[model samples]
Target: MPTIVHEFDWPDRIVVGTVGQPGARTFYLQVRGGRRVVSAALEKEQSAILAEKIDEILDELMAGEGNPFSIQATTPVELVDNEPLEMPVDEQFRTGAIGLGWDPATAQVVIEAYPLVVVDEADIELSEDGDGVEAIVVEPEEMLLVRMPVGTARAFAKRTREIVGAGRPLCPRCGDPMDPEGHDCVFPEA
Candidate 1:
């Protein structure tokens, strides 16, 4: 079957938002254009990495000779979006892999997210000779494709970082996340 693509070109809003409380939060990459909205569940680490990489890309462009693309060093003030995620976020799928790219033609950042692939024992088949087991290659049924302008991309990265940092505070002693109740920090013995 052909893969379903939720393509958004220059979406009106795109953001990384959490559903639950800090420690038990679930990260979501949501995109909206017009009345259509798509949300993909993703790990906190994935969200952070995505934002970091995007900023890196933008910074590199900004450092280019003569700053040809006019990449902003920081997110544009007018493009800042502090609003919460759209209500009733219906997650389309759990994101397994994410791809990021730069589109020079449109001066936009392209992001693609693929759903997680799960293999079941039932998917395995016996070989023609019935001697070996053959595994069926599973492919994602749906994916999300979003493209944003440079300024929007920068704003997105900034917002993502803030959302991620809003989570559990770190235990200064061990550099581990501290629980709301308390934290039992472990240290290496000399």
Candidate 2:
């Protein structure tokens, strides 16, 4: 199948948001502008990793020989998600591999996400689909590509980090995430 690429060279608004409860939350990356909008769903881990990588890229740029990371504008440094999802909230795909890079000439950061394919051992035990005739098939993979200014990329990284950390707090005892009700931590302290 041909690869489906969604490109947003300079989106008016690009943001990451989570829906549902903390532990069961769903992460979405949305870009809006030019009569087009794309939203991709991804695991929380992927989101966190993406944010970390972006941060690393910025750090490297800042430490470059002459510091070539000077793509700044009047855009707000903080992330604002006031804009609602571009209706329907249709997820393009479940992100598998994420890629990022900096274009010096354009001073823009390129972000890419590939669809993920999941396998299950229980599939071998299944006889047929609910129709009792056709079998389940994997969905075609799609990729999302977005190019934005360095400053905007920085804001995205910061906001992503914040969102990922905004989940349940750590239980100082077991070094695990704590629930609101309580935890069954055996070792309350070391």
Candidate 3:
């Protein structure tokens, strides 16, 4: 497992962005605080899941009491460095376990990313009585953590959804992503 190189409790900025064009894009989660900045490469699906989970957590929080999710639209969330990531991002590991929660006391959303660890059926064990043993998954070293106010999280969720959704739409014929040059459709109309 790659060690958690860095962890920021309250990053100055956390945002998701793409490097390439729609069809040929590379999604990245970047965090910045003061003079330090770290960017990790992740798959598009991971980006989508991250955004979805964040929204779900925020929605659940708003379900109770007054609407605490009403964040302003013009929240300041500027990306510190806009320069494209160096030729090859070193630690481009697929994201593993992600944790999200709303801290009512601190009034900030907590987001964490762990190194993705694949578990196999053989890894699971059974108890002495043949009853399935509860498999315990220890939390891996966190890739990064962001404890930001509601507005920051809201802006992040909104921008993430937009960035992930900005990809090319699926092709009608083959159900595959269509490129600007057009994809070869297998199910050509007869």
Candidate 4:
């Protein structure tokens, strides 16, 4: 678990912090240059929980009523992937905060830690030849296949499904999901 300071303005300060085990998540908050900030990210559906924990930890941090710092391993939080990470609420908002370029407010705000950065394997899709993307999968950074037996494969698939879900739609042209179909897109599909 890394030490973090909430980057929020006045009255806001370091609230809580968490670290993840293998395939888990890490969270934290801190204060630097007189700003409070929260730092974390879950699949998407887990934002609220992380936000809640940040609030809770803020309460605890304020208990001392001085330069504050509070840290703890969160109670397994369910992430948007529908899998439980030993952190607080499953927060997918972490990605929204970071990936979507949603910066912490410079004025009146909440603060906490979020983990959005990850070293992911290259993703492979079925391409334009498949039936609406037979599958979208991720393997280790440079690996080509899973080296597991049937039973392990089943278990892994189950867990992955629990984590990745059916899969989120993407922008056909930009290769990102900015809007659903039927809606106008800045970058139209060719």
Top candidate, metric lDDT: 1
Residue pairs in candidate 2 whose N, alpha carbon or C atoms collide under 3 angstroms:
none
The candidate that achieves the highest TM-score relative to the unseen native structure: 1
Q: What lDDT does model 1 reach?
A: 0.92
User: Residue 185 of candidate 2: its Cα lDDT?
Assistant: 94
lDDT per residue as tens, model 1, 37-117: 999999999999999999999998899899888899988999999999998999999999999999988888999999987
User: 25 in model 2: Cα distance from truth in Å?
Assistant: 0.7
CA lDDT of 169 in candidate 1? 92
In model 4, which runs have C-alpha deviations exceeding 4 angstroms? Answer: 1-150, 158-165, 179-186
For all candidates, the clash counts are 0, 0, 1, 35
How far in Å is the alpha carbon of 37 misplaced in model 3? 1.2
- Kindly list the per-residue Cα lDDT of model 3 for residues 1-190, writing each as its tens digit: 6556567778877788878788788787877789777777678888888778876777677666676656443434552233444444455455666677877778788877766777676765444544755554544554766788766777777778888888898888777888778678889879
Model 2 poorest 10 in a row by lDDT: 71-80
Say which prediction, candidate 2 or candidate 3, comes out ahead on lDDT: 2
Score candidate 4 by lDDT.
0.33
Q: How far is candidate 1 from the true structure (C-alpha RMSD, Å)?
A: 4.1
Sorted on TM-score, highest at the top, how do the candidates line up?
1, 2, 3, 4
Candidate 2: which stretches are off by over 4 Å?
Answer: 71-88, 119-140
Against the reference, the lDDT scores of all candidates come to 0.92, 0.77, 0.71, 0.33
Model 4 is weakest, by summed lDDT over 10 consecutive residues, at: 141-150
